[model samples]
Target: MALMITDECINCDVCEPECPNSAISQGAEIYEIDPNLCTECVGHYDEPQCQQVCPVDCIPHNPDMKETKEELYQKYMIISAA
Candidate 1:
């Protein structure tokens, strides 16, 4: 699954730079994770970097954008190719 920044985000700004896919960005109110570009750091790290750095723990798996580990790796490969 992709990850999402919830309303609980404190705008701490730590998560943005930690995203290997560059999927996290400053939204109108909070940081938002773009599902299309998110791979949960599958090919880059053992864990989601943003989730690791987020102080408020507002980032969570996006149930609405579920994907298997294989799918996430595919996405990561595609993104890396680009």
Candidate 2:
């Protein structure tokens, strides 16, 4: 599944750089995760880097954008190829 930044985000700007796919970006308010670009670090790291470095613990799996590990890997492959 992709990940999402909740309203609890402190906007510390740490999670943006941690995303391997560059999915995290500054939104109108708190940071936002692009589901299209988010692979949850399936092909880059064992764990989501943003979640690991996020001091506020605002990042969470996006239930609305549910995806299997295989799906995430496929997405990662596409992203990597491009």
Candidate 3:
């Protein structure tokens, strides 16, 4: 599943650099996660980096764009390959 930044995001920019997949980005209102680029850190890390570092705990699983662990790994590999 992709990780989403909720309204509780403090915009402290803590989660941006921690994302191995480069899925998090700054937005007008709050930080945003690109589902297409999000692999939930499956291929790169044991757990989601953003969620781990977020002080506000605003990073949440994106149920609307769920993917199995294998699929997430494949997605991450595909994007990071190039």
Find the candidate with the highest lDDT and give its number. 2
- How displaced is residue 67 in candidate 1, in Å? 0.3
Candidate 1, position 28, lDDT = 98
How many clashes does each candidate structure show, in the order listed? 0, 0, 0
Superposed Cα RMSD, model 2:
0.5
TM-score of 2: 0.98
Overall local distance difference test of candidate 2: 0.96
Q: Per-residue lDDT tens digits of candidate 2, residues 15-74?
A: 999998999999999999999999999999999999999998999999899899999999
Question: Model 3 misses residue 75 by how many Å?
Answer: 0.2
What is the alpha-carbon lDDT for the whole of candidate 3?
Answer: 0.89
Evaluated at residue 48, the lDDT of candidate 1 is 95
Q: State the lDDT of candidate 3 residue by residue for 1-82, as single tens digits.
A: 8878889988999899998877889999999999999998887789898988899898989989989998998898899886
What is the C-alpha local distance difference test score of each model? 0.94, 0.96, 0.89
lDDT of 1 at 50: 94
Model 2 regions more than 4 Å off? none
Model 1: per-residue Cα lDDT over 21-44, one tens digit each:
999999999999999999999999
